[model samples]
Target: MADTTGPISTLPGAHHSVPAGVMCDDHPDRPATHRVQGETDSFGCELIDMCDECHGEWKAYRDTPQGGVCDWCGKHADKLRPRRDYEEGMYGRVYDVCVPCITRANQEAEEELERSGWYD
Candidate 1:
């Protein structure tokens, strides 16, 4: 079993939250970090933000009718289905990629961390 003691974790871990919008799949040595939707096994499936990666490695959400970040390259996600489902007062889900803007962003972050010697 996983640790579950937070107020949010009061509910089932699988149904707690799933943030919406941009997310990072993360780079090696540095865990993933992004505001992303959840993984799914079917279309219009519910997604949630996983913390294993600060973001997290996508749980091999393969063949899911719902598309997400490229399992490779982590780029070009326009092919992903847009978020069109919303329930009042319900938690939201997010997709990892939607633009090529992350390369620069990641690079900048890496440099900043490197300068600070936090690249270990």
Candidate 2:
């Protein structure tokens, strides 16, 4: 007979399966399966691996005006819309922006294009 009731025997490996704990910064009682990394007023923009429940909570917070804040200017309101804008040279990389910031960026892009004679 072998002594199997040991820490080494219970270690996560080919013979043993260890369950990963909840990695969500907000919810610690659920299993984390989604990775959220971006700028947030409440969370201060960082990489957070969260569970589905926490992710939903985050989305709700991001979509609501009172819960969501502008990532660019740190402005908080209930009317600010969430915008996903792509960055230059960052393929498929989209980040959150406020309505005002997106509007400003669009205006700037239009002005730049006009100045470059790209529209003409």
Candidate 3:
């Protein structure tokens, strides 16, 4: 299996994109500033356009008492890294997730694919 233990930016694959002038699906009142990427979807991907306040709240919510942490695990880290590829898709970018979490997520994704007979 390919290395699933690297930053999301290091992983090669397509990301999500939405239409322009789209409002935050979560908050229709606010203009979408962040494109939140979720699992891969059939009709494009599960992309969400989030407002700045929502995005900031999301980051704060994902953070630990010590400092910012991985998007997956809540473990505290000195610094978080962004997935550049996913980030550059539209405007909103991938949250600063940690390497370990990225690796684990990739591993889980690979395992899921294997279970689903994606390789077979």
- Choose 2 or 3, whichever is better by lDDT: 3
Candidate 1: stretches off by over 4 Å: 1-77, 80-96
As a TM-score, model 1 comes out at 0.25
Among all windows of 10 consecutive residues in model 1, the one with the lowest summed lDDT is: 1-10
| Pick by TM-score: 2 or 3, better one | 2
lDDT of 1: 0.38
After superposition, which runs of candidate 2 have C-alpha atoms over 4 Å from their true positions?
Answer: 1-22, 26-29, 38-45, 67-78, 81-101
- Writing each residue's lDDT as its tens digit, candidate 2 over 5-93 gives 21111111112222365355666665566655443332223345666786678788766554467676787644654343434322222
TM-score of each: 0.25, 0.44, 0.36
For model 3, the stretches where C-alpha displacement exceeds 4 angstroms are: 1-18, 41-44, 65-120
Residue 96: error of model 3 in Å?
A: 16
Best by lDDT: 3
Residue pairs in candidate 1 whose N, alpha carbon or C atoms collide under 3 angstroms: 18-48, 23-34, 24-34, 36-94, 37-94, 38-47, 38-48
Rank by lDDT (best first): 3, 2, 1
Full candidate order by TM-score, most accurate first: 2, 3, 1
Q: Residue 87 CA error for candidate 1 (Å)?
A: 26
In the range 1-120, model 3's lDDT, one tens digit per residue, is 011122233221232344567787668877776665543322233455668887788668556443476665778877665543332443333555777777766788688889999899
- Preferred candidate (lDDT higher): 1 or 2: 2
| Alpha carbon lDDT of each predicted model | 0.38, 0.51, 0.55
Q: For model 2, what is the error of residue 83's alpha carbon versus the real structure, in angstroms, after optimal superposition?
A: 8.4
